[model samples]
Target: MIQRPRGTRDLLPPESRLWQAVEQTARAVFGAFGADEVRTPAFEPTELFVRSVGETTDIVHKEMYTFEDRKGRSLTLRPEGTAGVARAWIENRLHDRSHPLRLYYIGPMFRYERMQAGRYRQFSQIGLELLGADSPLADAELLLVLHELFTRLGFDDLQVHLNNLGDPEDRPRYQQLVRETLAASREALCSDCQRRLDENPLRVLDCKVPSCQVIVADVPPVSTVASEASRAHVVAVEDQLDRLGVPFVRNPRLVRGLDYYLRTVFEVVSPKLGTNAVLCGGGRYDRLISDLGGPAVPGSGFAIGEDRLVDLLPDGFKVRVLGLRRLYLVPLGGAARAEALRLARDWTRAGVVLEVELTGRSLKAALKRADKEGFAAVAILGDDELAAGTVAIRELATSSQEVMSPAEVPAWWAGRS
Candidate 1:
């Protein structure tokens, strides 16, 4: 038998229900924030990410799934959501209509990375972008939205790690400091860190190698070199978060992996996930829109990994599936089966989930199947019941039977607890 490719998953029942819950919750939360939903293609011209995410970032340099189309255009599956959203906003000229276009997206993203627990080569992300806003409140609001989502989803013990990468002007000075500092210990640093020191020195602060971590620990903090304006912006964001009752920690070394981030950066971490503790990471990308061919626009956003978020859900927490009520239709005779089919459509439209017997199963067999499959109730139809213009509905839980007119079945099911 052929197996599914690695790092991807087929969502079956119950698990799919859980995914639906997450999507629905995101829709509700983002909608409340006036964020309209936006969707972009799963893939785009490779240059889009290269330009927006920065050439030196891990997502663009190592993780992207780049390939040539038949026309030989270098296209790549999106490894993250922000770049695509930014591209769409520019191409569509959304900035022309609104000062701040609040957009949210939930979809699959592809990467060519080693899979581990809660990490996949193919993963899903739920994110929102507030374009055209430079206010520190916009940055703080993004954090608040994430905190609300996690709380609504029953998550506790979440720690928000906050930092200021400073504006573009402040970053160069800090990068020079980091580069010079890392160069002094080049022999002790990992090969990756040494390479990053030249390509993107700030990434050296994010290195995870034990030896590099030791070296990075001694480096001057980004805040040390932050300009007065950048420092004030961060203080404003912190004050707003405090006003909103959102608790956070200031981590000077918490520069995000993406190079687009500037001024304010943050990660929401949970100890529950062990070493890969970051559940969400995002920050202000004030220049991303212009870098990707649009006019200068300030944007702040964050993305929560659906895999990690769902994995942290309470054990055995089953989502309430939304749809028609669960009621099976068991027909004993040919005429009853025909009538059942007609009634099935009407009942479905009226908000009653009906499963008609298609395999010519006897009433006893159909009832047995319904019971095993966990239907809330079953409707028994036979020649006698059809002639009387009534159907016998059995409440599966109590095995209690009651006769009701076909037209009243929907109302009866609706009234069921």
Candidate 2:
């Protein structure tokens, strides 16, 4: 039998409720912050990522599933949503309307990597991007949105790991310092870290291996090694976070492993998940639009991994639906079945969760399944009841039965509860 691909999942009933809750909270929070939703296509031209997400990054270099479409147009499933949203902002001319277009997206993102327990090839993400603003107030607003979102989600003790990549003017000096430090321990560095030493030194700050972690810990913080301008910019973001009463820690080496980020990088991490499974990540990208061949634009935003966020959800709250409380129509004979189906629709119109046997089964079998299915109460339309324009309704939990006009069943149910 064919099966779902590796690193993907099917959300079954009841458990699917968690996804709804997450989406609901996100919508409420983002809407309150004036961020309208942006829905972009699942696929885009391959160069979008190369230009915006950075070709040297792991997402582009090792993870993207690139292929040519029927028309020979190079398209690929989007690994993340931001670049496409940015492209939409440019293509739709949204920038001309507002100062900073606040936007959020929720959807599946694709990646090809070795599947781990919580990792998947196709996972969902809820991300926020604020385009066309550069003030610290904008940064503070974003941080407040993120902080309140986590608090509202009931995730306590979340650690915010904050850092500064420093703006473009001060990044080169920090890059030089990183290269010099990496040169001293280059032999001890991992292959990926070594290769990144020159091109994007900030990435080496994210190594997870035991040996690499120890070595990287000794490397000077990017803030210490960065230019004075970089230092000042980082300080401003911190001051904003403090002013907003958002708690955070300064991790000198907390550079996210991406090339598009120019300054003010940050991560909201949860130590509960065995030391640093990041819940959200994003930073500033001042030159992304220009690099991608659009007019210059400043962007700062973050992506929340839904898979991780769901894992952090408290247990027992499930997808709540009108389940077994449904009125099951067990017509006595063929003609009665037809009448029962018609009655079921009328009952539905009155806001009743009603079920009629679809399978051509014996009355006893239908009754058995109704009881087994845990319906709250069932509406049975045997020939005797149908003759009177009435149905026999049984309350499953109480084992009580009554006769009522089909139209009155919904009101009867509302009264029953």
Candidate 3:
């Protein structure tokens, strides 16, 4: 049968509790924003994504998964998570410690693309980075930790957008007004915007090809090349997200392909995610550590994809794993089935989840298979409660039975429910 592979799948039991309740509420909102976990390395050095996600981005020209390494080198398979957390802050000098170095990460991120509905070609991401500061409260603490992790994951209608992409002397005059407005319609666009109209003219205004969004719908808005010191760093990141009441949306053709971003940029959209793209995106790279050779320390980060957030949650959700209960021991044959398998292995060594009917089922079919596996009580030990040294405790959702005493059925199944 040999199956399961193409774009992966297979997380069964209770659908992995929507990835452990959105990865334990995104690790308790990355420990309430103090950020700490950092584990980068699922392959790299494919020129670190053509030098920090550029080479005209389509996640590095036509979806990366790259190869080469049996010594030849190239290597890839990383497709995002801030260039391996900025190549582990420049090969671990972690800028010799101190000053905004907060961090975070949650795995899996290959990208060959083309899978739909919450997209996945081996996908999953959950990120947050904030290295050193350049204030504006580090872009309002990344829009207040993605607005408190989409309001603690219930995600009721979101949308934070906001953009600036300025600085680095105003992104080369907004990439020369998007290459003189896509060179007067580079032969009517889309051939991947005519090879990205000279490698990334704001990714041809993020084309989604409705005839290249009806030919860049009158082109213009790269905030007409901003720069009054990048318009006061976009009004100091929207006056600190309007002095922290935080709700945003400037959009204006938000570019973000990462050549170490300069001015603020963000995204957190979701009108219940069936459309408006991003569920989390981040910004403010501030010259990604002196353009990846370290020494220029400013940063910002965000990522989230817990496998398309378990198809955007809200179905039967379960994570309450505190079960442990079986204690069957129903011996009715051959020397009380060897003393019901030695008192079901000594009531599972004084603990609990013990079982016996090794396929001889009869105490009402082993208490109906311990009330279909959700057993919160079942300690019979038949042969007439092993001739009264006691052992009954049935409950199984109150079918009520209690006889007790085989050393008080491990303190009566620890005072059950």
Candidate 4:
């Protein structure tokens, strides 16, 4: 038998229900915020990521799955959602529609990398982007939306780690400060950090190596070298969050891996993961549009790792979505079996989740299967019930049975609901 590739998964029954519930929640929440869905290709020209996500970032440098087409043109599966959305914003001329476009996307992203728990080579991301807006209020609004999403998901202990990456002008100075500070400990740094120090020093702060983190701990905070304007920008964002009751912490070391992010960058970490897994990460990328050969448009958004989010979903939500009360119709004789479809359709149309048993199984065997599958109730139709135009509904939990007319089944199910 052929096996699925490593770092990939098949979302099977019940669990697939959880994923659907999460996506449905995202749609309702985002739609309430005046955001419409947008979809781009799963893959695009390789340069799209190289230009937008940054050359030195892990996504562009190591993770992306790039291949040449028949024409020998390079195309890559997207590793993140924002860059593709930015490309779409420009190429489709969406920027001309309104002052700021509120958009959301739910899709798969591909990356070739070492897999770990809650991380995958093939993953799904739910992203929201606010384009053409540069106000501090816009940044606050994005965070607010995230807070609302988490609250709706029943996440009680998620932390929003915020930091100032500063404007483009302040980058050279901050990078110089980072390099100068880590110079003495360069030899002790990991090979990745050492290379990052020269190529892009900010990436060094994002290093996960224990030793590299120790050396990077001594580096000065980027805010020290950040411009007064950028500092004030983040301050206003914090103020807005405070007033809005969106809890967050100013992590001097917080930095996103992408190159386009500047001014405001953040990660939402879940304490339930024990390892502080980041379920969502995003920030302000004001220059991304211009960098992608489009008019300069400021954008702010974040992408939630749907795989990780579902893994840590609260028990309350799981029970509510997965514990659906369904009716299993067991038709015992040939006539009753033939009538099963009509009964099932009527109950289903009445908003009752009903399943008709078509296989030739005895009433005892069907009841066993229904109990095993966690059905709340079973409707039994035999020759006697078919002749009397009645059905027997048995509640699995209580093992109690009730005889009712076929037309009364809907009301009975509604009362049970």
Candidate 5:
């Protein structure tokens, strides 16, 4: 038999229900915040990511899934969501609509990387972007939404690790500082960090290698040489967060892997997964649109790694979503089976969650199956009940049974629910 590719997964029953609940929660929460959904192609020109995410980032340099299409033009599965959003903003002329477009997207992203627990080559992301606004309030709003989302998901141990990467002008000075500080320990640095020292010195701070991290620990925070204007911008963001009571910690060494981010960069980490596992990461990318050949429009946003989020989902949330009550309908005899569909349709129209037993299994077998599958109750329709215009309802938990008219079953189920 043919097997599925190594890095992909089939989100099967019950487990798939958890994913649906997550997506639905995201939609309701983001929609309440005035964020409309925007969807782009699963694949785009290879140049899109290179131009927007930067040439030196790992997403572009190592992880991207790029190939030549039938027309011999390079195409790539999107490795991240932000760059695609920027490209869509330019190509579709979204600038004409309104200032500060609030858009959210949930979709699969592809990356060719080594598989790990909670990480996949094919993964999904839930992202929100606020475009065309540079105000500190916009940044605060994003954080508020994030806090609300995690709260709704029942995550209590997550933390926001925030830092100011400064404005574009301050980058030259900051990069110089990193190079100078790590110069003495250059030989001890990893091969990746040594090459990044000249190409993109700030990338050295983001290195995960134990040796590189030790050397990078001594470098001065980027805020030390930040331009006065840039410093003021991030300070305002922090003040707003404080006023709003959204908790966060200032981590001097925090740096996002993408090149477009500047000013406010952050990652939300879960102690349950250890500090290295980032559940969500995003920041302000004021120059992304202009860099993508569009009018300069500032934007701030973040993407939650949906795969990992579900993997580390709180036990309470899993139980609530997966343990929702559903009724099993058992039809006895050929005549009862034929009439079952009509009753099932009527009850479902009345907002009842149920499934009719399609197979001709015996009543004893059907009840056993219902109990094993955790059905709240079983509705039994037989030749006698069909003739009498009534049904039997059996509560699995209480082992209680009641006879009622077909129309009354819906109300009874609703009451129990």
Candidate 6:
């Protein structure tokens, strides 16, 4: 038998309800922050990511699912959300409307890598991008949005790991520092870190290999080499976060894996998800719009790995499934079944959840089935009830029965606690 591909999942039944809750909560929080929802294609020209995410980043170099179309044009499934949204902002000329265009998106992203807990080949991300803003407060505001969202979702213990990548002017000097430090310990570095030392030395700090981590521990903080302006920006962001009561720690080695990030960078980490799993990561990208062919615009955003988040949800958290009202209709005869179908239609149109039984069953058997299926109320229709144009409604909880017109059933159910 054919099976689902590896690193993918099928969301079924009540589990899907949980996913819906996450999305709904995200929408409510994002909407309150004045961010309108935006969607982009699942795939785009291969060069879009290569140019925006950087050639040496793991996402572009190893994880992207790139292929050629029939016309021989290169295409790739999006590995992340910000680049696509930035492209749309540039292509659609959203900059013409307002100085800051707040946008949010939630959908699947593709990447090819070893499947681990909370990591998959096909994953989902909920992200928000605030475009046309370039201030330390903008960075703090994004962090506040993330903190509010996770808190609302029942996470009380979360650490916001903060850092500064410095502006373009400061990056070269930091890069040189990283190169020299890693070059001295090149023999002890992981294979990936060894290659990164030559191509993009900053990425070596992001390596998880034990030996590489040790080598990076002695390296000086990026802030040491950052220009005065970049250092001041970090101070401003920290001051705002303090004012907002959003606790964060300075991790000078916290350079994000993306090329577009400049100045502010951060990750919200949850202790519940083990030592290394970050729930969300984002930062300021002041030049991304221009890099993607639009006029110069500043933007900052973060993407939450939905899979990891769902796993981290509190055990007592509940999702109320809308439109499943636990009302069942059981008919004892052919005429009663026909009448039941009619009532089902009317009740459904009136926004009542009703299930009509098509299979013929004795009244005793029908009531038993309703009880077994956890129906809150069962409407029994027999030839006598049909002739009288009414239904015998039994409250499953109390085992009490009442006769009411088909039209009155909706009101009666609605009035029940």
Give each model a TM-score. 0.93, 0.86, 0.34, 0.98, 0.98, 0.91
1-417 per-residue lDDT for model 5 (tens digits): 999888999999899999999999999999999999999999999999999887888788889999998889999999999988999999999999988899999999999877777889999999999999999889888999999999999988889988999999989988888888888999999888888897889889998888778778899999898878877888898999999888999988899999999999888998878635799999999999999899989999999999999998999999999999998999999999999999999999998999999989898999999989999999999999989999999999999999999999888888877
lDDT score of residue 94 within candidate 3: 83
Q: Write out the backbone clash pairs for model 1.
A: none
Q: Which runs in model 3 stand beyond 4 Å of their true positions? A: 1-13, 25-98, 101-116, 119-126, 133-172, 186-205, 210-260, 263-284, 287-297, 307-378, 381-417
RMSD of 6: 2.5
Alpha-carbon lDDT of model 5: 0.91
lDDT score for residue 244 of model 5: 89
Candidate lDDT scores, in order, read 0.87, 0.80, 0.75, 0.92, 0.91, 0.88
Which digits, one per residue and each the tens of the lDDT, describe model 3 over residues 1-417? 999778877778556756767778878887877888899888888887787778887888888989896778789889888878888888989888887888888888888877777777787798888888887678787778778776766665677888777777776777778788768778988788888777767777777767887778777776677776766877788888888787888887777666677677777766766544676777887676676677878788778777766676543233233243445556655656767666666666877666566777777877787777666666656577677767677676768787866776776776662
User: lDDT by residue for model 6 over 1-417, one digit each (tens)?
Assistant: 999999999988667777899899999999999999999999999999999999999899899999999999999999999999989987887878876788999999999988788889999999999988888888888999999998888888899999988888877888899888777789889888888888888899999777788889988998887778877887899999999999999988898899999889999998877756699999999988898888888889999999988878876554344324578898887787767777888888877777778778777887898888777888888888988988898988898999999889888888873
Q: Decide which is better by TM-score, 3 or 5.
A: 5
User: In lDDT terms, how accurate is model 4?
Assistant: 0.92
lDDT tens digits, residue span 1-417, model 4: 999999899999989999999999999999998999999999999999999888988888889999999999999998999988988888888866977899999999999988788888999999999998899999999999999988998989999999998999999988999989999999999988888999999999998877788788998899998888999999999999999999999999999988889999999998777654688999999999998899988999999999999999999999999899999999998999889998888888888898889888999999999999999999999999999999999999999999999899998999888
Q: In candidate 1, how many Å is residue 189 off?
A: 2.5
Give the runs in model 6 whose Cα sits over 4 Å from its true position: 319-325, 345-351, 358-374, 395-402, 415-417
lDDT of 2: 0.80
Alpha-carbon lDDT of model 6: 0.88
Instruction: Evaluate model 4: give its TM-score.
Output: 0.98
Residue 160 CA error for candidate 2 (Å)? 2.6
Give candidate 2's TM-score. 0.86
Residue 394: error of model 4 in Å?
0.5
